[model samples]
Target: MNTIFLLNKTKDPTLSEWYERKINDELRALGIKDVHCKAVSSEPMALEITHPLVLICSSSILRDTYSYQSAEQVYAPHAKILAIIVHEKVKFFRHRFTNLQFSPLRFIYNPHRMPLRELIFHLLSQLDIDLEVRR
Candidate 1:
């Protein structure tokens, strides 16, 4: 099964929990039984995950906590990395992450602006997962 590792380092714990619930709920609604979604706060735990993975974390997590060099050491090329950048910081984050060697690093600006379904679709698409392939 495909696994989505959400590396939440957001300021609001409630918002983080809500995001996790939304992703899992949406996956079920989409009949995507083969994919599993989980939220992780530890960087070591996040790095240890090697399944068909999708990472969701905030810009602050990337910028202030983890560096691209450190991430490149642990992150596989096939893994789809998504950064949730605050609305005002999108430009800075875009400029920073865009130049990385990673091919498909997606950025979600102001996540609260979009519906949960839209977020789920975008994330699942990045993994190139076939929802029909059930376990």
Candidate 2:
């Protein structure tokens, strides 16, 4: 089973909780298991995480807070990072994740207010292995 990690750097704990619940809930609705979350408030976390668990980052990482360095370090020749960006905030994606030396990182942009199912489908399709594969 592939382990998926949900990492959010948002300052608000409430938002973190909401995101976890929403993402996990949607994953369940899609019949996906082995998906989980671990919130991190600091950079360099990429160094500690193992592979097979896709990293799901929040929009806050595009800003000055732990965004650049985290993205850089995680962009190792073998690292995989998926960024969820809001379309209105597309400007932030510029030259941000360029140094990634591994398989192409995945990205899915919604209104940030779209239904959880929409984001879940987009995420699953990118991995190329759906819930059925895990089962």
Candidate 3:
């Protein structure tokens, strides 16, 4: 089965939990049973993440470079990653520099610009996961 690792290493606990639940609920509602979604606050040391789809859902991830680096070290070199910008308060300079550090891995979603459901669908499509939406 395909797996999704939702990484949220921010200071906000509630936001982390909310993202976890929301993503899981959205995937469940989509009738996507083949993919397993797991949320983690920090780098998972115990679990062996085999080329899973990773989602970085933290507002301050750009500010905390260590977390990003740690994640890079943990996941497979070819693993697909998507960073979701939960907040837009990151300074211009910081955002630019931090983005440079996150080379190759692009920020795919900004809640202010697009809905989470849209992002999810886009990701699923990219993975070639075909499923009929249940009304």
Candidate 4:
């Protein structure tokens, strides 16, 4: 199943993209080529366009992407959401909102601090799709 990774442009776009590329590579390792790390700017599109099996995003982007509404309207009924938050965003977010809808990754803080492999493992273990391609 496809995985949607909603990402923002960090202070260093180049470095951020490089890291994103690596994340994508990990997704590839899981045989998920349909992964996407989209910015919040491009929205209002059908959330089911990809019909992703999982949704991942940083906490800082929660409001910026209009994510609450977007996810409510777009995310598939069965898809799980993984919220990757930064250290500063953690305290408030953990208890701030109790979402019964999706299962978040719940890292200590900072999306980057969470290992891409661990993230993939989480998704794979949960989704458990028989990959069509093995590479």
Per-model TM-score versus the true fold? 0.58, 0.53, 0.60, 0.42
Highest TM-score, which number? 3
Local distance difference test values of all predictions, in order: 0.54, 0.49, 0.56, 0.43
C-alpha positional error of residue 20 in candidate 3 after TM-score superposition, expressed in Å:
1.8
Q: Cα miss at 71, model 3 (Å)? A: 8.9
Model 2 lDDT vs. the true structure? 0.49
- Which is the winner by TM-score between candidate 1 and candidate 3? 3
Model 4 over residues 1-135: C-alpha lDDT tens digits?
Answer: 354444332443344355456667877676676554433332344233444323333445444344434343434333334433232234355544423222232322244344556655554544565555443
Off by over 4 Å in 4: 1-20, 28-41, 46-50, 53-109, 130-135
lDDT of 2 by residue, 2-106 (tens): 544554444444554566677777777667776554444434664466642334444544455443354435443234555443333345456655223222334
Candidates sorted by TM-score, descending order?
3, 1, 2, 4
Return the lDDT, model 4, position 118.
Answer: 61
Model 1 alpha-carbon miss at residue 20, Å? 1.6
> Candidate 1, clashing residue pairs?
none
Measured on C-alpha atoms, candidate 3 has an lDDT of 0.56
lDDT of 1 by residue, 1-135 (tens): 777776654555555456567778878877888776777666676666665344444445445434434443434333436544242234455444332322234445355444556556666666777555232
Error of 3 at 69 (Å): 11
